[model samples]
Target: MAKGKEARVMIILECTTCIRKSENQKSPGISRYISQKNRHNTPSRLELKKFCPYCYKHTIHVEIKK
Candidate 1:
């Protein structure tokens, strides 16, 4: 049987702080997280508060295009 389109799609979430302070490469690199969400569930961009070792704090992470 042929499988239909996947309901869940993988997405990447990047730290907002890291994006703003991209110039500061003192630590290592911009903080990014790999995650998945239901395309049908969330048509808009997904945002979440996650931990960032680079920022050493929880920051808002927004989904970015792959």
Candidate 2:
């Protein structure tokens, strides 16, 4: 059985320079979001909001790593 709630990890993502006309700007985008109510060392699903330096806006992201 699982001991506690799944772990939550935070990853930083940068926008493609070509996509946006911005100078050297790196944003902290939520690269992962998972909801594993069992795993202990694994990440869990949760609400994450991060700002994109290139896009200059906040975007929603989901867990993509396992």
Candidate 3:
């Protein structure tokens, strides 16, 4: 049987730049990416550089807990 917490967890990655820009500028919303990671394999939060259409550039996307 698969334990609830043992399965790969789904996380959301939001663009850091987009978040900052939203504070100063009027924008639609934050850019977020959905991904999965194994809890056992990656004990720490995952971060990736991804393209943000709203920001029109690449920015650091940090993992956010639900």
Candidate 4:
């Protein structure tokens, strides 16, 4: 069975720059970050600045559906 909608959700954030690099065949794999947000408190999708090892710099990590 699926979990209830009221439960806190964990979102996946992926590096934009890393994704571009990967599509261009410059990276071995995609970089991702995981974070938890309260559904009621944060209804909108979250965007965060996080360190990407592949990018070697901080980049915008946007929330993605599971």
Give the best candidate by lDDT. Answer: 1
- Compare the candidates by TM-score and give the number of the best one: 1
Candidate numbers sorted by TM-score from highest down: 1, 3, 4, 2
Q: Evaluate model 3: give its lDDT.
A: 0.88
Residue 50 CA error for candidate 3 (Å)? 0.9
Candidate 3: where is the Cα deviation over 4 Å? 1-4
lDDT of 2 at 64: 43
lDDT of 2 at 27: 41
Better of 2 and 3 by lDDT: 3
TM-score of model 3 vs. true structure:
0.81
Model 4's C-alpha root-mean-square deviation from the true structure amounts to: 3.5
Residue by residue across 13-65, what tens digits does model 2's lDDT show?
Answer: 33333233333454443232233332455345433465544346665543343
Put the candidates in lDDT order, highest first.
1, 3, 4, 2
Lowest summed lDDT over 10 consecutive residues: which window, candidate 3?
A: 1-10
- lDDT string for model 3 (1-66, tens) is 766566587899999888887889888789999999888999898999999888788889999878
Candidate 2 ranges with C-alpha deviation above 4 Å: 1-44
Tens digits of lDDT, candidate 4, 4-57: 676588899998888787777868677798899999888998999999887788
Superposed on all Cα atoms, the candidates' RMSDs to the truth, in angstroms, are 2.1, 7.6, 1.8, 3.5
Instruction: State how far residue 17 of model 4 sits from its true place (Å).
Output: 0.7
- TM-score per model over all chains: 0.85, 0.31, 0.81, 0.80
Rate residue 47 of model 4 by lDDT.
Answer: 91
